[model samples]
Target chain A: MKARVHVMLKTGVLDPQGEAVRHALGAMGFDKVEGVRQGKVIDLELAEGTTEAEVAEMCEKLLANTVIERYEIDLD
Target chain B: MKARVHVMLKTGVLDPQGEAVRHALGAMGFDKVEGVRQGKVIDLELAEGTTEAEVAEMCEKLLANTVIERYEIDLD
Candidate 1:
């Protein structure tokens, strides 16, 4: 089984890294861009039969800093 | 309009950061965890009426590095 997890800063957090990237893109000429935020994705090749709840539990227990981030999961 | 974009490394790419994260999680005692891959998410608050194609074009042109990653966009 395969699981795809996306982890990102919670809303209202300041993302300096994202801001830097935004500035970089502007310099690279993508000036239509007006906002930028950055987060993270985690791909897992799980043992067959891994349940969505198991993955969600993993996110809560280890994969995410819940104080600063939230996560979404996709199963494939 | 809003778009949720997920950007991630292509298969076969070596993601040192992800490897490090996996190791870190292991150290944190989540031993059922067997693998990890890290990517990024970019959220866009677009002006209403933004087409999917336009968002995809933005991704191809600026939001993702196609040589190293693939992206998925969701409109909401």
Candidate 2:
């Protein structure tokens, strides 16, 4: 089994990293660019039988900083 | 219209950021945690009529570094 979880900054959070990208893109003539938010992806090759709820809980508990970020998980 | 593109390193690529997260999670007492990869998300608020293919082109041309990262876009 494999799982990939993506964690990112929540709306209303200030993202300096994203801002820097936007600035660079704008300078490169990408006027269509708006905002950028950074995130993380975790890949887990798990032993069979791991539950999706358990993985979601991991996102809530340790993988994501809920104070400023939201997360989504893809399981296979 | 709005578009959100999520970009991250492709599989088999070296991800030091993800490695650092795994190590941190392990130190924090998570035995199940495995690999971690960092990525970015860009959010755009566009005046209607932006095509998905065009957005994907922007992703390839500016938002993502194809040498390492792959991207997915969401339209709304």
- Candidate 2 per-residue lDDT, tens place, B1-76, comes to 7887878789899888778777876787666655666666677665468789878877877778999899988999
Question: Which candidate achieves the best TM-score against the true structure?
Answer: 1
DockQ category of candidate 1: medium
Model 1: how far residue A8 lies from native, Å = 2.1
How would you encode candidate 1's per-residue C-alpha lDDT over A3-60 as one tens digit per residue?
8888888889998977886787679765555677888778887777778998898889
Candidate 2 A-chain TM-score:
0.86
Worst 10 residues of 1 chain B by lDDT: B24-33
**Candidate 2, DockQ score (0 to 1):** 0.44
Badly placed stretches (over 4 Å) of model 2 are B26-29, B33-35
lDDT of each: 0.81, 0.76
- Candidate 2 is scored at a TM of 0.73
The DockQ assigned to candidate 1 is: 0.51
* lDDT winner: 1
